[model samples]
Target: MEFKFSPLAYVPFVSVENMIKLVNSIGAETFMSELAVAIEEDFKRWELFDKTPRVASHSDVGVIELMPTSDGEMYGFKYVNGHPKNTKEGLQTVTAFGLLADVDSGYPKLLTEMTLLTALRTAAMSALVGRHLAPKGSKTMAMIGNGAQSEFQCLAFKAVCGIENVRLYDIDPAATAKCAANLKSAGVNVVSCKTAEEAMEGAEIITTCTADKQYATILTDNMVGDGVHINAIGGDCPGKTEVAEAVLRRSDIFVEYPPQTRIEGDIQQLPDDYPVTDLWQVMRGEAEGRTHDRQITFFDSVGFAVEDFSALKYVRAKIEGTEFFEHLDMLADPSDPRDLFGMLS
Candidate 1:
């Protein structure tokens, strides 16, 4: 055998800024649609994924959660907190961080602040589902809960669905004002409405990404119109919901992963027997999506870990040799594989 040596390979440590830049370079539409395909690819072989329901720790103040998902090949996890009251204290409502690691080596490849990426991916996921459920010639969208995730959702719809008009409403007028001011330069017809009903008028797609952690009905059956696609995002955890039970019952519901969603999605309010469609089947062409223009369709988005997997993969592919990066030393090395603790010293 010929004598050979290997050099230590450095891992790319992407920051929130770099990750956003990477996503921008790929074009938001490309990143989102590609993410939809990646999520579908992973869901097709759901049995291969090490799917653990999110681990949540709740306190009187707020909630902290850890969502982890892996395919026995690549591992990813996100640490995010939902503190709806944070904004009252002049802080962000959701703060998050995540990591991507190689399952074989248990070595972390990238560590990133997911506060921004969460907004990006959540918006992307919403638009992807809208791609299937929304009616053709849909040009307007109504956005409820115009908070930190509001701008991203606005941009996502335009980039993904070609939506040109965004109607916005929030319980807090300041938040709605913030959203309007931030997105003013995007060249869309932005409307700040007084009520949810006012926002949903003439809209093809309705999105709810509120910060409330209670079962507050942001949208009711009366507010909805025929053929409107609803993207419910805020009702993500126990005791957290944005849609009325009547609305869910009247509409055809689609979910990412049914088991976790049964506990976290709007379906949580429904009886166990209440029917809902798993979106993976739709992606695979096994189940029907938006069967009729008059049928109401709802995507119960609770934020899936698979989106992080897809986001990381997309970032890696686009930023192959970019200069806005870092090399991190986060893994340990041991002379003997069995003596894991020996490398700590």
Candidate 2:
């Protein structure tokens, strides 16, 4: 008998263009909804996942992070950075890349540039929260911190939550104008506001994805009115939060994972006894989502590893036939499993 396996083959590396085409082909709406379901599924079986807090390196210039998660069968990781000053360097404030690997073989099955995918997934997660938490016939969304994430969030709300009119605001008027121009071209009804408060006027959903990377209070208590679903994405790290502490105290706080979020999400400012609900319970029908039409809902989105897992799965699914991956020699295989030193020799 003869055993045949390919070792010298190239790694399947996915480029940004390949990822865009794959996501577009699968239909952005379907992909987002499916990813939400995937996250929910992972959350339901929470005990199966080998999870850990993301490792982060912070500098005066910016912050870089590595998030890894595994299910004893498959492993995935993403490398992402946040540099608010990158625009001055003619680079995006956030640039990311990620990998999906097989746990048994410990080989990366697919590696992709997730700069665009991160924006997509971040927006998708926000919209999913609104879908489950916001009121029916929700049309308007107030988007604070209108930077790189502005357009992505707007498009997602429109596609997923049926939000047509987006109220946009940023400290930089140019940033607001740029986002408005891009979104208008995409058939989105964008209204640039002078202040974040004006944007919140009549908005059913409020999403904050600022890149300040500090304790910058973007959303004030007065701005957050009733019947609004607040998707807090910017305040995802320590010492960085968008909404005021009073906002979380008043609203029915919901988080992806409470344990990791108590340190990262906007809820960090609150005391230990501060009440909140985990989103998984709502998905499992174990807890209620929106109790009433007037209840203010807050989703403290800290960019969980599970959402990245869902996004990676979606990206790999679209790369079925096409060879969008680059084969890298990151692993070594030997005839015997126990001979780890032999491979090094």
Candidate 3:
């Protein structure tokens, strides 16, 4: 696993093609499971990390954000954009890249495309929370959004929580068909449903991930039953949400970070002081998860910086001694450290 170059001077880059090959080589299920373990480990040590809400710049059609965190030794940040309307033009709704840097040197150690990594980490985070919060012996999940992220969520749950079946529903029938086709040989049963209610049938975990700009209710109060874990991810920016307000009132909510969730998660629809359990605390055993079989546990996921940092760490470890990553000449090497013109000369 030794590097060919001095690690400080060369940043490893994982492109989309390389990332695809990496996932295929490790098998998607195994990669998702390992990534989930990485995320859980980071969450357990959350107190050591500097946490903050994502900084966002919004526009009429989309929003771009910078999510950054540090653990005293290393710093990581992701540059991501979300455009819900992009799908109409045959483009991805989310695109991202990220960097991991040495805290003291302030020099990047790795630069990688995060669009694929984000999907992997997000699914890992969701399924990891499901392992801790979902009904015991849960085997089925209802996925309400059948877009780009649907397949990853399905496989991650199957790998980590033993979910054997997924009922898929989307407003666009073609999306559901595409998702079902993609999951045909994924080793989990894929059911294409006509409505959200149909998708929820016999599902112990309900995941809502619709892409919309405004507060849209993908799941209503009546549709959500007791004893189910709700994974809400699409409501990542202000004014965007997927679950009903009443649903939030009935569930014991869990969040990555309360400060950010209040602005971007489904809890944004609730009062400022509404109760929430930080998921990291649950991982650290400072708080309880799924105290009762009938209790509704909700993971108001907004995709945190720490999760991205963990994913970056996992990718770096997995790509070492492999050709999945390329070294980029991102930093200038100067024999005279203080001479500005020495490197060029």
Per-prediction TM-score to the true structure, in the order listed:
0.90, 0.89, 0.96
**RMSD of candidate 3 to the true fold?**
2.3
Number of clashing residue pairs in every model? 0, 8, 0
How many backbone clashes can be found in candidate 1? 0
Candidate 2: which stretches are off by over 4 Å? 1-10, 27-30, 333-345
Looking at model 3, report the run of 10 residues with the lowest lDDT sum.
Answer: 1-10
User: What is the per-residue lDDT of model 2 for residues 63-160, given as tens digits with 9 covering 90 to 100?
Assistant: 89999998787799999988878888899888899988888867788788988888888888888778889988999988888888888888877877
Candidates' lDDT values, in order?
0.82, 0.82, 0.92
Please write out the lDDT profile of model 1 over residues 168-258, one tens digit for every residue.
9998899899999988888789999999889898999999988777888999878888888999988988788899988898899999888
- Residues 17-123 of candidate 3 have per-residue lDDT tens digits of 99999999999999999999999999999999999778889898998999999999989999999888888899888999999998999988889999999999999
Q: Of models 2 and 3, which has the larger TM-score?
A: 3
